[model samples]
Target: MKNVIITGTSRGIGFEMVKLFSEAGHNVLALSRNSKPVSDLKLKNVTALEFDIANEPEVVNLSAYLQKAMKTVDVLINNAGFLVNKPFAEITAEEFKRSYGVNVFGVASLIKTALPFMKTDGHVVNISSMGGIQGSVKFPGLSAYSSSKGAVITLTELLAEEYKETGPSFNVLALGSVQTEMLEEAFPGFKAPLSATEMAEYILDFSLSGNKFYNGKILQVSSTTP
Candidate 1:
């Protein structure tokens, strides 16, 4: 029904999103550092692309590929992220850079490249964390990850305003901990209240129909109120 591009589709939320959108009959361009997972899906409407989001050359290649494959994009979901949990003192500079490289720069690059192919009134959803929301629950050892998500929220707001007179709408979804591999890694032994599939379903519906009512807003998706 629509042309959708989702980044970080190797697994977890991104993977579920690829299944959700493609099964709904949308043309889905799924990006991941490794294409094997999506490749195995064998979905008729899904195209798997292999590339690291943190790499500029790969992103450029994605842009060029999209230019040739799609005339217009209805949705762009920036779902790729890097997380490193450690005490603030133990957080290395390299770690921070790595986190920002994927969480921040990767997101910016995709938006920059995808906008040209986006149809008027298209939706751009940047996946963020609840920790990124001001006054939200704080956790130790999430310095880099939280900070990067915060930056994503800011960028979404600014981009939305910058493109107000134009076409596409930009929004950030600051989600609570979801039950996924990323959550397991970030908080070992702890169980998250929401599942990735649930989140993906909501995101698919919002991107396809509900996004027009909102622009430049950061909605915190969580069972527990922040």
Candidate 2:
């Protein structure tokens, strides 16, 4: 079973992914700003660590902790992200910086730290959004978030090409509106857009296959039945 590192595991999709992967018999290193609530599902092969993803020191400390624990990360899931819903014209510098701080810089920092521990046949999955895709549009207030996701997609593609000769694969999962706390925070008073469990299941299945078809591509999943 693969040893995977997932960020933003305190709740929502990241939390569900930890459960899904651990239940699949994989070792999971779950990271978040807060400790995950105690649960039977978190016992055994799943270990949770609390750290601010936006902080460079915390990311470095986490990397060192994993190394000291003699854990090799076979898969790195850059899942920690944030959304700021405000019109582009009204978005403040602080808002834009915070958006990129978590979505882009934090993800890059974790990947850099984990790359050394990753085996030749390892994998890296960056959790992006459908908003990153070309021509994809969202609520007018989501300019900053959408832009950051777009950057993620670009980073994924560049990394995939850079690691083409390596045995490991790099991919981006451009998720459709998934029901998570982030969604609720972004659009208050709105119903869930998609079930987190269903999306997590699909992601787990895709990750286990170790296929290259999705490499450097955006894989979008939606619950909306057409």
By TM-score, the best candidate is 1
lDDT of 2 by residue, 1-226 (tens): 8888888888888888898887789988888887645243546688888778889999888867887874687788888888988779998999999999999989888888888887667888898887877776565887888889889989988987887777467888888777788888887776755688877787777776644465676776654410
**Alpha-carbon local distance difference test for all models:** 0.90, 0.80
Per-candidate clash tally: 0, 1
Residue range 1-226, candidate 1, lDDT tens digits: 8999999899999999999887888999999988999999799889998879899988888877887898789899999999999999999999999999999999999899999988668999999999898889888899999999999999999999999888699988998888899889887898877889999998888877756689999988888732
- Runs of candidate 1 with Cα error greater than 4 angstroms are none
For model 1, state the Cα shift of residue 128 in Å: 0.4
Tell me the TM-score of each prediction against the true structure.
0.97, 0.91
TM-score quality measure for candidate 2: 0.91
Ten-residue stretch with the least lDDT total in model 2: 35-44
